[model samples]
Target: MSRFLFVVLPVASHLNAPLAIGQALRAAGHEVAWCGPRTDLRPLIGPDATLYPTGKRYFRLDGETGMASVRTLWEGHVLPVNRFIRDAVDRAVADHRPDVVVVDQYALVGALAAHRHGVPWATFCVGALELTPPDLPGFGDHVRAQLGRVWAMTDLPVDDAIDLRFSPYLVLGLTSTALTGATPLPARCVLTGPALGHHPDAPAFDWAAWDPSRRHVLVTVGTMAEHLARDFYRRMMAATAALADRVQVVVTASPDVLPEPPAHVLAAPRVPVLELMPRLDAVVSHGGLGTITEALAHGVPVVVAPIRHDHPTVARQVTDAGAGTEVAFASATPADLTAALTAVLDDPGYREGARRVGESFAAAGGAAAAARHLAALAARPIEHCPSGTAALA
Candidate 1:
């Protein structure tokens, strides 16, 4: 049995995908270990695998919830986080001495470690990755340029030979072929779609409890950026009140990490999206990829109000695909939102488009296909890698 190590981000969505893969590997009789911030190790350690938690402070923030806050931290932490992961992953690789390694898009250090050790490696990009092709090596320059607006630091001057120089095997973008009409990429840089784990078995809630007589808008900024949605969310509540007879509103507030909302909106705080998306007529969100995917997966039309980082990137994708409307933060006034959502919900085309994309997302074989690809790649012979001090690849 081959041995492997994984360096994954310690978030619910990000960690879930890689942890599932590691568990799958263990089920197939391979030995697997996880190395990272280690906030949640239980998910990575199935009956067969080992969990390694690198002791490091991931982020320091209190009661901050919103897309803006999440964006701020990610931007500021990239360099420092990369440095920390690099050191920790290097040490772990030396100790575990796994034959292969895997990481999330955000886990740069593990990728570097695999390269240094001459082991096969893959990066599972669970978000909207820069959509450049593998044949074009210099596309990193172009990617940084365009994505720079959303992730301002990415567009800044840096060593151009970063992404592909280290990882030539699999930059598995969370893209489904059915949606983009883009052909599958080479083995080294395939657009293997999202690998979400089976969602938690949430307590079943009554969807019929939400009345359909009035317009219903569910507001979610994202797990990290629930704070940024406060203004838009507040506006939505006011609009629902103004049109009380014409609409009903519901929101699952971000945990205590974010402040309580205005009483007009019922803060069903901690209601997981899996329980809520199926009941919503439409979603008002900061355009988190995961949220957008889930909403569409449930055939719910969306009005995207992007804040930072990949939010705008994902908004453009949905718009380009004719799946939703983009509502920039500057123009997200209550009246504007009411009008925009009214138009979108009234239009059958948006619903049809969302349904089509959701079908495409499903047809592309999300998690299972990713698992198959990963298993195949892991079984392949480890590639020869260059030697270095084992810095961030």
Candidate 2:
């Protein structure tokens, strides 16, 4: 059995996909371990899973927008975290001695550590940030330059051929072409769709409270965007208020955000999202990849109000696929949200689009496919090609 070590960010969306994949590998008799903060990893992964803790550190974007958010993510979070956890990751590798290191896209140090140890590694593209379109010229180049700088900072020789962001062996993109449209990706990249699975830490909700007589709508901006979502939630409540008799809006937020939500709205700090998806008819969200993909996997349509980071890109993909509509996050009025939400609910075409994407997700094999690929990579012989590039041969 091959040993696999997953080096990931502490964020929920980033951790979920790899967790699912790790579960799959374990089911196949492979040993799996994770490297991240213990407090964050323990609850989600359960007590049995082995963990190499990097301790706790919080990284915040503080509501930046567009390219600035991208800069903040790399400069403020990714780089700093990489520097902070480099020693921990090195120790994990030295001790765990994993045959394959599964590296999150943003966790550059994982790839570097694997390379240092001469271990095969795979890239987990949990979001749409790395799948930038041609229209955004130099975006990929800029990201690659950042990766180069990280390597240089480690005093490691920068092999231009080796892009640390992606593994030459395997890259598991947690999305399908249905959402990504015609965006080009790396040759080694496998669109494994979204690894939709159970989250052990998901909070339970009172399913009995749900009103089946009216259409159900979920309004959430995911975990990271809560600060930016207070105003968005206000706008969403205003938008859905008129339709309260016909539609039930479930807002996932702290009571403070919606202290006295209308009678028709259900407010919560967290909800059983996967369990609740089948009951949902439509979702109003911040265009997060995890929320969008999970909703689509259940054949539930979405109305995206992109907040920041990869939100706009994922929003465009959803709109382009005809699976949903997007609105300005900061400036979109209640009227805009009302119209968008109404269109997805009223129009059968949007549901059909979501259904098609959902079918594609099923065909893509999700976590099982990722696990199979990692297993194959583990068994394959790593050889230097004619140009001195290391790859599975």
TM-score of 2: 0.96
Tens-digit lDDT string for candidate 1 (195-253): 55544433444455566666666776656656455666667766556656665666767
For residues 1-393, write the lDDT of model 2, one tens digit per residue.
999999988787788899899989999999999999998899988888899999867886477876667777788888888888988998898899998999998888888888777787899998887755424555666677778779876756777888887887789998998887677888698898999766888887877888989999999988887877878888889999979989998989998877898888999988988888999999988988989999999999999998877888898999888899989888889998899999999999999999999999999999999999999998898973433277656
Worst 10 residues of 2 by lDDT: 131-140
Best of the candidates, TM-score: 2
TM-scores of all candidate predictions against the true structure: 0.77, 0.96
- Prediction 1 TM-score vs. true: 0.77
